[model samples]
Target: MRTEKEYVQWLMSVPRVGYLRCRKLLEQFGSAEAVWEAPAQELLQVPSVTRNVAEEILVSRQSYSFQEQADFLKRTGIRVLHKKDPEYPLFLLQIHDPPHILYVKGEFTLLDDKAIGVVGTRTPTNYGVLVTKNLCTELASAGVTIVSGLARGIDAIAHEAALQAGGTTIAVLAGGVENIYPPQNSSLARRICKQGLLISEFPPLASAHPGMFPVRNRIISGLSRAILVVEAARKSGSLITADQALEQCRDVFAVPGPITSPLSQGTNDLIREGAKIITGVADIWEEYPDWQANYSHKMKDEAFQLNPEERQLLETIGYGGVHLDHLIRVSQLSQGEVYRLLLEMELKGLVKQLPGQMYMRSSV
Candidate 1:
C-alpha cells in the first residue's frame, strides 16, 4: 500500500499523462500499483490510455525511481499534496480539471472562503498600479486573502500590497514554485513563502513556458470566490483569467479606467458584457453578503440624532462608500471631525461601515 502511494506520486510526475487522464487511469485500475502491474495490453484497455501512452508508461516505469523523487522533495523542503490528500485545496477539487499533484513550497493551509483573485497585464498604467495596490491593501486589511498569478505587473503589486497590509496572500505560479519566473521577483517570492504560500501544479524545477500560463490562470480563478482584473489590454492573459473565473462560477470584477486608455479597454469591455464594476470593496460585499457578515454594520440609538454636518458627510460617502481618509480629503473636513461624524452616521443606520475604516450609504 505504501509503495502504491509512492507509485501514484511517480505517475503524477510523468509527462503527457496530465490531470484528467491520471484521474481516469486511477479509477479504471483501482490504484497506481494496479496500473503499474498490469501488462501493456491491459493498460491499453483503460479509456483514453492509448497504445502509445500505455507503452510510454511501461517504458518510463523502468527508470522512474520513487525514492529519488522523494529524496529530492525532502532535500528542497517542498511538499506534495496528492489529489486524495485531506489537505488538498477543496476549492480546487470543484474545478473541471484539478491537478492530481500540487508541489507547494511554503506554509499552506486550505484558504479561507473570502479569497479574491487579482490579475492584470504585465505592463500597467500609473492609475492601474496605484489602484491595484490600494484596493489590494484595503482588501487585505479587511481580512480578505488575496490570490494572484505572481506575474510582473498588477499581480505582483497585489501580492506586495497584501503583504504590506500584514495580511495573507497566495501566489499561484505559472511554473514550478521553486523556479520563480521573471527572476526579478525572486526576492518577493521568498517573502511570500514566509508570510503566505507559493503553489504550483508543475514540478519543483520546471521553468515557465508560454503555453503554461493559460493553464495556470484557471487555478488562480478556481481558488477564489471572485476575480478582480485591475487592468488588461484587450488581448491580455488577465482576460483569460476572467473567462476562467466565469466558467468556474466565480464573480468577476473589473476596475474602470479612462475610456481611451488601452489598458482600460479590456476592463471596459468586461463591464459592458455584465461583469461588476469594482469602484470599492463594498461593491464586492454586495454580491456575496454572507462573506460580509463579520463586517456588517449596526445602528446605534444616537445615530438618528445627526447634525447638518453629519448629513453632508453621509452624502459624500456615496453608494460604494469612501475610505475614511478619502472622505476627509474630499469632504474637506478634519480627520477628527470625519471620524466623529462617521461614527454618528453608523449609529443612525444612515451609513454602513466596511473593513479598513471605509463607509458607504446604507441601502436599508
Candidate 2:
C-alpha cells in the first residue's frame, strides 16, 4: 500500500496537475490517497479541475509506480517535504503560494531561517562580480545563508563566495535538483549539496522550461528574510525576485552601481523606489539588529570569552573582511587601540588578518 505522501507524489506526476490544482484536490478529498481513489466525477467537483485534468489524473494513476518513485528518491538520497511537514521551511510557508512539495538534495536546518536571497543579471559586469563576492562572503561569514537561483553569473558567484567563506547557502533550481540546468553548474551544485542545499518544487528528473524560471523566483524570495539584487538590467528576471520579495513582505535590498551601466539600471531603480541600499554587510546588519544579538548569543554558547572593547571590535569587523581604516573609523577607536585589539584577537584565533590590512572573523 502506498503512503498518503506517495499518493501526493503520484498526483504531482500527472500531466496538467500543478501545485494549486493538487492543493485543491487534496483539500476537497481530505487526503492524497482519497484524491487518487476519487472517481472522475468526484475529482471534477474540485475547483479548477476540468474534465480533461480529471481524466489525466485517473489515467496517470494507473501507469504511475509509487515503488519506482520511492526507489529513485532513496537511491539518489533526495528528500521530499510537503507543506504540512514540520521540517518544511517556516519562512517559505508564509508566502501565498508556497510549493506543495519541495525536493531537497541536501541538509536543511533552522540556521537557514536567517537566509538572504542574492540574485542579479546572468551576464554581470566586473563591478557586479566584485560587489556580489564581497557582500555574499561577508553575509555568509555572518551566518546568513545565501539563497539564489543557481544561474550563470551573479548567482554562481554568490554561492561560491558563501562556500569559500565556510558558510551555508541554498540554490533554488527552476528544474529538478538532479537535473541541474546550465550543465556547467553541475559541480557547483554538488558543492552546495555538501555545504548547504539544492532544492526545487519539481521532481528529480523534471526538465526546465523558460516559464519555470519566474515560477522558481518566488521560492527564492519566500525562503529568504530579504532579497538583494547586485546587478540587473531594466528588464531582468532578478527584478522578478525583488518584486516577489515585496509582495511577500520580505525586505528588498539593492547594491547601487554606476549610473552609466545598463546592468545597474534595475538595482538603481530599486534604490530609488525605496529598496534599502547596501554598500556592505554592515548595511544589511543595520536592518536586522536581532541577527547581531543572535551572533553574540551563538558566540557565548560556544564559550568564546571577550572583554567589552574586544566584543565591540569583533562586532565592527563582523564576519566579512573589513579594512583597518574602516574598522578604526567605525569602532571609533584610536589606531593603536584598534591594532592592539586586532593583534590580541588574531593570537586568540578569533580573527585573521588578510592582506591589504583587512581583518575578518575566524571560524574558531
Candidate 3:
C-alpha cells in the first residue's frame, strides 16, 4: 500500500476531487499507486470527473511535490489522514459517502471515542442555549465525546459544555484545520485543538465558504453514534445533520423548546416524526448502558426491566396511551388478563392508570 502521505497527495492532486469525489476514486481505483499510474483518459472517464481533473492528474504525475505541504502542515501541527489509514474514522466509513481524507489537529484517537453529534442553530434562542449546554454536559459526563460544527451559538455551547465536564469535544470544520471561520471563534478553536480534536475534510490552505457547510454537516453526523439536535429553525443546517444521521441508521434525539421559539420548529417536527424525545441524559442511557457505571447519578439508581407480561402490556399501550378496554381489544386478551398486566405494571412502577382507567408511562 502507498503510505498515507502519498495517498493524501495523490488525492489532492486530482482536480475538483474534494472529499466525496476522492472517496469514489479510491473505491474504484483500489489504491493511490494504481490510480496514479492509470491513463489520463481513464481518469477523465471516472464518474462525475471533469476534463480539468484529467489534465491535473497528468501534470501532478510529472511534477509531484510533497515536501512543502508536509513542512507547512508540520509547522502548524496538523496531521493528514488518508482513506486507508487505520486512524481514519471507522464510523464515518459506515456512511453512504465519507471523506477520503481528513486534516486533523489534536489527539487523533479521539475519533475512537464513542461519540454523539450535538448540533443546532448558529443563531440560537435562550432555550437553545440552556438545553444545548445541559445535554452536552450530561452526555460528556456520561463518557460520550461531543461532536459538532464549530460555528457560533449552539455549536459553541456544546463544545464548551464538553470541556466543562472534562470530556472530549470534536469540532468538524467546514473550512480547513488552519482556517477558523466566524473570525471571532479563533479562541474557541484553539481550546478544542488543545483538549479534543479539530477535524476537516478540506486541506490546510482551503478557506471558508458557505457552500462547504452542507458537506461538513454530513461528516458531523457520519462520525457519530447518534445525533442530538438541541435547537434548530425550520431551515437550520442542523436539520441536515439529523437527516444524514437517519440515513446512516444512527439514532437522532432532539430537545424541545417553547412552541413560539423559532428554534423549536425543527426539533418539534423531529419529535412528531418519532425521533427520540430526550429530556435528560438518561434518555440516551439505554443506548450507552455500560457508561452508567461511571456516573454517580446513574450508579445511585437501580434499573427496571420488563417481563413478558409487562412487555405485552407496554406494547398494548403503543406509542400513546390506551384505555383498559382498548388494551384488552388490541392485546386480544380477556379483561382479567388485561387487568392482571396493568396491575403488575403499576406494581412494578412502569405505568400509571388515569382517572378513567387509561394507562400511560409512569413519571417515575
Worst 10 residues of 3 by lDDT: 296-305
Off by over 4 Å in 3: 1-5, 13-15, 61-64, 297-364
Sort all candidates by lDDT, best to worst. Answer: 2, 1, 3
lDDT of 1 by residue, 35-150 (tens): 77889888888788887888788887898877798899899888888768888889988888877778887777835346999999889887788778767765676578899988
Off by over 4 Å in 2: 27-30, 44-52, 293-364
Give each model's clash number.
2, 0, 0
| Candidate 2 per-residue lDDT over residues 131-212, each given as its tens digit | 7876776677668899998999999999998898788999999989999998999999999999999999887888888888
Top lDDT prediction, candidate number:
2
Q: RMSD for all candidates, in order, please.
A: 7.5, 8.1, 10.5
TM-score versus the correct structure, for each prediction: 0.76, 0.78, 0.76
lDDT of each: 0.80, 0.84, 0.78
Report the lDDT tens digits of candidate 3 across residue range 200-231: 98876677788889999988988898999988
| lDDT: the better of candidates 1 and 2 | 2
Ten contiguous residues minimizing lDDT sum, candidate 1 = 296-305
